[model samples]
Target: MRLERAVDDFVVQLASERGLSANTAKAYRSDLDALAAFAGGRGAHDTSDLDLELLRDWLWQDSRSGLAKSTIARRSAAARGLTAWLAREGHTTADAGARLRAPKADQHLPRVLTRSQVDGILDSLAALAATGDPVAVRDVALIELLYASALRVGELVGLDLGSLDRSRLTVRVTGKGSKDRVVPFGVPALRAIDEYLATARPKLAARNSAEETTAIFLGARGKRINSRTVYQLVASLLADLPGTGPAGPHALRHTAATHLLDGGADLRAVQELLGHASLGTTQLYTHVSAARLKDTYRVAHPRA
Candidate 1:
């Protein structure tokens, strides 16, 4: 089969059979499209023309073109997935990318906020909510739940009214790979949610002429809030704060996890709370905690 056709089929299988998220499938598709273009330029237009050398050269070309190591690594993985699928489905005689490799991604610690910085952000949001504006009230609930539960922005925006268990102080969120887990939030988050539900959601919902949305958070247009809006809200809040890296909602997630570790939460429990499939993923917070402690020691130790 044509390489492009095979790439499309593999992407469909990723979404349908493997149940990968749309964003993940899209990323794979993007990388494979580039590979298909590269292959076509070399007159290797069919899956049979694919070879390990071609795959390695594709990665080498990308590296020479100045793609980040992380991006190149992801591209290599995307190619491997495609070639493996092609071989499995009998399109190729061998998995050409079975031994394909790329430079390992650079390890940069995720941006985590200080506890005092988080408190100051919450205080400002609460003060805004005091004005009785529907959007302001919703923002309070949104940020509170975000920091409280360390929810991914996609998961937070995907929440519906049925997702919350108020008496239990937990929310049912469908995370990456469509996995659902119940995550707990603090009383402060509950208070903000209650205020939003009482004074904000109804006002926003009233503006909708269509059937009422079951979404827990509404956009300005009364539809379910989208991830971009949530990102903008977080970016605006974090813009003035002193930090580098992304200022998006995931910073709150990193902050929450690091804080949990600093407070003596078990690695396994945090792994479960964050819905991470791997314990190693959750362990990144321990490194963040250690870095913070070392910074404190450098600043406060009189012996130095």
Candidate 2:
């Protein structure tokens, strides 16, 4: 089979059988497409032409091109999956890229906001919301719920009207892999959501005459809010803050998780709240906490 044809089939399987998210599937497609182009140039146009040497050469060339280690690692993983699938499906006699490896990506600590910074952000948003602008009200509610529940931006935007259980102070969100979980928010988040639902959502929803959006968060156009809009809102809010990492919605998430750990929240409980698939993923916040503690100690302890 042609390399391109084999790649297409594997990506389809990733979506249809493995149920990977659209973003994940798109990333795999991009990686595989690049590999296909590279292989074609090297005269490895067919499945049989994809041997261990050609795969290693492609990755080596990518490394020499100065691509980030993370990108190379992801591309290598994509290639490994493809070759394994090809071998299993009888397109190839063996998994030629099974032993291929790439440099491990460097792990940078996530940007976390101090509690005072979080309070300041919320206070500023609350002041804007007091103006009665529908969008401003919605933005306050969005940011509050994000920090309160440590929700992924995708999960926050995916919320529907029925997703909220106000009586229980919880919201049902569809997380990664289409898994559903109920996450509890604090009274502050509930109050912000109440204000938004009562004062803002209807006004925004009325923008479209023929249709009503069931989404909990609405754009200015009375449609479900997109991730880019949420990203822009978060970036603008975080822009002036002291941090080096991304100023996106996930920064609020990282902040929330770290704060939870600092306040003596259990590790397993936090894992459930954040919808992480692994405890190790949740443990990243522990490292953040330890780093903060060391910073505080160095500044306050005069014995050094």
- Go through the candidates in order and give the C-alpha RMSD of each one to the true structure: 0.9, 1.0
Clashes of each: 0, 0
- Candidate 2 residue-wise lDDT at 67: 94
Candidate 1 clash pair list? none
* lDDT: worst 10-residue window of model 2: 205-214
Provide the TM-score for each candidate, comma-separated: 0.98, 0.98
**Residue-wise lDDT of candidate 2 within 260-288, one digit each (tens)?**
99999999999999999999999999999
lDDT of each: 0.94, 0.94
302 in model 2: Cα distance from truth in Å? Answer: 1.5
Q: What value of lDDT does candidate 1 attain over all alpha carbons? A: 0.94
- Give residue 19's error in model 2 in angstroms: 1.2
Residue pairs with backbone overlap in model 2: none
Candidate 1 segments exceeding 4 Å error: none
TM-score (C-alpha, index-matched) for candidate 1: 0.98
